[model samples]
Target: MIKHIVMWKLKNPGDAAKFKAQLDSCKGLVPGMREFEAAVRTEGLEANVDVVLVSAFDDRAALQAYLEHPVHVEVSGVLGGLRESRTVLDYET
Candidate 1:
């Protein structure tokens, strides 16, 4: 399986909910999506980023399909406008 993790620091921290919601919208968007989770940092958490997404795919091809899906592309555009910095990691597990 492929593990995909993304952390984002928003241009405006107040928009974290919107950012998370946009990501959540992509759940079950593509075939071979094993898992999908999006979360906002807790109020008292010690973290550098504002939001996170942890997902798993059956393989590299499935991960690629998710990345290229139209719904994902649209959601990414929304996320792009809201984020100041973004970090991503993808590796086989």
Candidate 2:
């Protein structure tokens, strides 16, 4: 399996709710997602990223398919507007 993890820092910290909603929306749109979770730093911890996304896929190809999917593209479009910085990691189990 492949685990795709991502973190994002929003342009406006106050938009946390909106960003999290977008994350859930994106997850709902993904067809082959084996698992998906979104989290926000509720503890007000000092961190560069405001939100985190942890997703699981069957393999690299499935992960790639999700990345190329149109729904994901649309989600990214929304995220691009709201995010100030982003980082990602993909690995296999």
The lDDT per prediction is 0.95, 0.85
Error in Å for residue 91 of model 1: 0.7
lDDT of 2 at 50: 89
Model 2's TM-score against the true structure: 0.88
Query: How high is the lDDT of residue 89 in model 1?
Result: 95
Please list all clashing residue pairs in model 2, or write none if there are none. none
The residue ranges of model 2 lying beyond 4 angstroms of the native Cα positions read: 28-31, 44-46
Residue-level lDDT tens digits of model 1 in 44-85: 869999999999999999999999999999999878989999
Per-residue lDDT tens digits for candidate 2, residues 10-91, read 8897887888888787674555679899988786577778889999988888898888888788888988998899999999
In candidate 1, position 47 carries an lDDT of: 90
TM-score for all models, in order of appearance: 0.98, 0.88
Error of 1 at 51 (Å): 0.5
> Model 1, which residues run further than 4 Å from truth?
none
